[model samples]
Target: MVASVFSIYVRTVHRIWRQVKNSGMHVDVSHKRTGNCGRKRIQIDLTQFLEIPLRQWTTLDSLACSINMNKTTLFRRLKSGAIRRHSNAIKPILKEENKRSRFQFCISMLDESSIPQDPIFKGMYNIVHIDEKWFYMTKKI
Candidate 1:
């Protein structure tokens, strides 16, 4: 049994030495297409692709597929301002009321004289409706 194992070990070492001598056998077999140099597909119409996003809030990749334009060209168009910024959605509301007086009342309670610095309130803290139990200090006019 030992003799057989020694024979196998000798055969394995011999095979390894033979393979090492043959350098081509160790070369990257997976890189069969290493020498291959193919023509690249050109991207077209970068301007159109770029403008679509700013005008419509969509991505260049998506817009390119839809209009059959190159993303690069679309970017150029956007840079030149061919595609403009979209119109704003927000509009200010004009309400008729004595807003200044209400603000003054709240400020007086905080005692701006004693407290030089004001704290920043979070979320809807300004529009609170407190009960009569929570009293605010106010001086006579």
Candidate 2:
């Protein structure tokens, strides 16, 4: 009657009814799949990987070639959290003149009157920060 009414297979209805009967009023219909059912994850030596120079770590193909491992496997390891990717930005080295200019700019911010008593910076209400990288002034002709 339940199979005909719900438009489901008789076997499925029987299985559900059997579960409810066995467990009393409440039925445990939760999924039985566990995390341990999958194939074991391949182990990687992180120390050996780190020993390779930072320059070689730029591309997965090059890094995998240097370590004698398949690129696909390396990528899988990266996705699985077994391996990490580090990106270090190359900062411009500041010269003595640049350092001096920065120091002078910092000094200029100090309140002249407060310097003698409690050295404090002036309330910088006029300062406006602009990212020049994406700020374009002209349209391409």
Candidate 3:
């Protein structure tokens, strides 16, 4: 059994040596076929993507169809860090009076023990119903 194992090992080493010599590949090399092993990745140009309006690329499926790629491929790009997802949020623009009112409301909600130097909240139970909205001056698509 030992002799057979030795012979098998010798045969594998000889075969590898022969292949290395014929293929002109380094004996100690690794990942020799790594570049050719996997399916080619899709390349998306950032400039082209940026040029497309947000409405056109509203969803992953829409964006993939617009760019002429499979949704799975596009999703793979997102997973592989080739693409990223962003949620755009607009902050409410408060006027001077609105700001003062908000400041006063916050002050009223403060814990009694809290002082001017270090203000603390009495917890947010009373302030849960607050909602603010911002409207653009011009129509937005």
Candidate 4:
């Protein structure tokens, strides 16, 4: 009756009853497990991780190989907030000459008449973009 009313297992109710009967006035029924209980979490050294090059950090498998750690363990660390995964896109390193050329190209695209008022690019109907790879593949030579 007590187990059904409390929505707890009969065995649990029996254990509590035993405790209360033994203690008479006071019954200490609290959780026994502490925060430190359970399997110890694997620790990751941030300094060592940071020392590895960006290229090695590209994939979890590569990183695991470099650090001598299991890929699954590394993945678990990532999921548990012990480590962070960053997706950094590779950007082209443009020189000053390249920058100047890009700027000149943008300047040429602007309408000359609109320079005095609101400057905007031309309709660009003359430009045709063709993939060099596709063009070369279709050619006989």
As for TM-score, the candidate ahead, 2 or 3, is 3
CA deviation > 4 Å runs, candidate 4: 1-29, 90-141
Error of 1 at 15 (Å): 73
Clashing pairs in 3: none
> Which candidate number maximizes lDDT?
4
Ranking by lDDT: 4, 2, 3, 1
**lDDT, candidate 4, 1-141, per-residue tens:** 999998989999999989999889687887678776999877888888878876677678888988889999999988888887664433346779989999999999999999999999999999998766544332211
Task: Give the CA lDDT, 0 to 100, for residue 90 in model 4.
Answer: 36
- lDDT for 121 (candidate 4): 94
Q: What overall lDDT goes with each candidate model?
A: 0.52, 0.78, 0.71, 0.80
Provide TM-scores for the models: 0.24, 0.38, 0.45, 0.42
Per-residue lDDT tens digits for candidate 2, residues 30-58, read 54676657887666777877788766765
* Poorly placed runs, candidate 2 (over 4 Å): 24-55, 76-82, 89-141
Clashing pairs in 2: none
Where does the lowest 10-residue lDDT sum fall in candidate 2? 132-141
RMSD of each: 18.5, 12.8, 8.2, 10.8
Instruction: Score residue 23 of candidate 4 by CA lDDT.
Output: 83
User: What ranges in model 1 sit over 4 Å off?
Assistant: 1-61, 88-119, 123-141
